[model samples]
Target: MQRKIYITIILFLGIVMNAQSGKVGIKTANPKETLDVNGVTYTNSLYLRNPGEPTMTGGSFLATSENALQLYDPNLESSGLFNYLKLSLTGISGAGVTDYDTKIDADKFLIVVHNYSFKMNDGTTNVALDYGDNGTNDNRQGSPDVVAFKSKGTWHIRARFTDSKLIALTSANPGRTYNNFTIDLYLMAYKRLITKQNINDITSDLGGTNGSSKTVNRPSGF
Candidate 1:
């Protein structure tokens, strides 16, 4: 009988595999971690994709201009609350019921104006009234939060804390006269997502028997 000797060897390129945990390591001789990258690893770009994920479209490293990023939740409805925060400044005649929906999450939307000077209706145009530019912002005798000064004079309104409805600019006196400058507001309609059905349910849960005349609407024919 003749005896033969053979030499065989297996090698890995600085990589380790854990079959139990399904983990891989790089540049590590004895890899005890999933992905063990020793030194600085550079990459030009990166991408994220979910083949069967729900609601999440994807992600990318390179930025785009138009509609590049999107997030969607199936629960949100088209009629749900939406808002535009960039509000237009108009003369608020006191806290009158201007022309808009005021009941938003107990007035979640707030109003503020730029401190930039404006052409007041009055002949003398004053510099924009800012926080530091006190004594001039209001006629309330140095009241901090007051926005208006004279009732009919030119008052350049600066920034204000977010409060009140989009259209209704609440003043100390709701009946005061506001002149010049048509204001528009940036709507923030999504502070709370409410549906028509939710309103009905609330009414019924509170008082109505739900199936009685209280909850039901009577038609014109009736």
Candidate 2:
């Protein structure tokens, strides 16, 4: 019994010392990470309670102080939503602007908030102060088309003005040099990784009875 106990202590010490330097692997001879596993994965509620992990229970997550959402928070009429994408459309002119498309990963949701628009040039001189070319006749539609949303996991935008402006501007100037513009739009794409329970928590916490899709009145500049 004394010899057996001595051998067990020797074995335990050997294992403890060896494990200090060796990476641990499950079903693997060599592990690339500190703790590596092979094949399928399974978890339970208790698994999420690991130390230093973010709370599994979600409600009004406050971002870090340097987060951009905090900066824009004051500008929004209704307080909610987080930034997912910051997209810019700049220095566009003469029609035929290539479409813009961004595809996010699976199970993600995208929301847009159009903010501001600006012009680099006034597009030709003097009497340009006219509003007669507003898609009425499809004669002078020189502006870009409205933003388009499609679900191949992408958000798409095409630059084309009202049909009337297309006709009038193309016919009159041909080059359409008088319509250079730029715009800033915000994309609020929620991460797919957000827990469903947290999502429900948002609905309950915010008192937002309107459901997921809230109507946004787009400014004319965009």
Candidate 3:
């Protein structure tokens, strides 16, 4: 009986040694990779470092542009939070609203305008205005009060101006014109993959009931 037990141990050790050059599977009979683990794997620490790169910062996830599980590409110029946009307003007269398609889907992405600059030109003259450049008009009709927002699956910038001293220029138009109006926008965007809903009202009664009421009026009332 002792001899049979010794023979069984020797055979098991030999089999393990032979499998060292082949695939090893855990909780599985057939392993597709070198170290295939079919069940959940738990590790105290995980590191994915590039060649010749120093140790990554702790408590933060890091990856390159071509990582296996592509969450975000840190190497991209416009990958993170901030991006830029330049728009030209053409053929717009007087104070009103103008809409531009940002080419960004309203559902999957959320964008916010941080800062902006504008350049207005009439034939040969040009005036540059910053966002907070709402001072009184000098020789030119200063900057218009521009309200930028995103709605209806696009971006809209509405410009309104107060009546100022009339200055001689190209055409007889008050405020700014769309012929040579250009705007530089600094924008921030967030990627979100979820259902979008509009909340008309928000009510909170601590430790009590909560409800919502919303209504829309139309020509054909029902």
Model 3 TM-score (2 dp): 0.39
Candidate 3 lDDT trough over 10 residues, lowest sum: 128-137
| Candidate 3 residue-wise lDDT, 1-222, digit = tens | 999999788755654654585966665556556665666666666664342233343333333343232334456524553355545454333332345566676665667666654444343334432222333335444345555566887656655444422222444333443445445556666554333345344444444434345343432311
Q: What is the C-alpha lDDT profile of model 1 across 12-56, one tens digit per residue?
A: 433423434555555555555555555656556645453223432
**What TM-score does candidate 1 reach?**
0.23
How displaced is residue 50 in candidate 1, in Å?
20
Q: lDDT of all predictions, in order shown? A: 0.33, 0.45, 0.48
Alpha carbon deviation, residue 188, candidate 3 (Å): 2.2
Q: Best candidate, TM-score-wise?
A: 3
Q: Each candidate: RMSD to true structure? A: 16.7, 14.6, 13.5
Q: Candidate 2 — which residues are off by over 4 angstroms?
A: 1-81, 96-98, 121-145, 164-180, 193-222
Worst 10 residues of 1 by lDDT: 1-10
* TM-score list, all predictions: 0.23, 0.35, 0.39
lDDT, residue 155, candidate 1: 24
Runs of candidate 3 exceeding 4 Å displacement:
1-71, 76-82, 90-97, 122-145, 159-178, 193-222
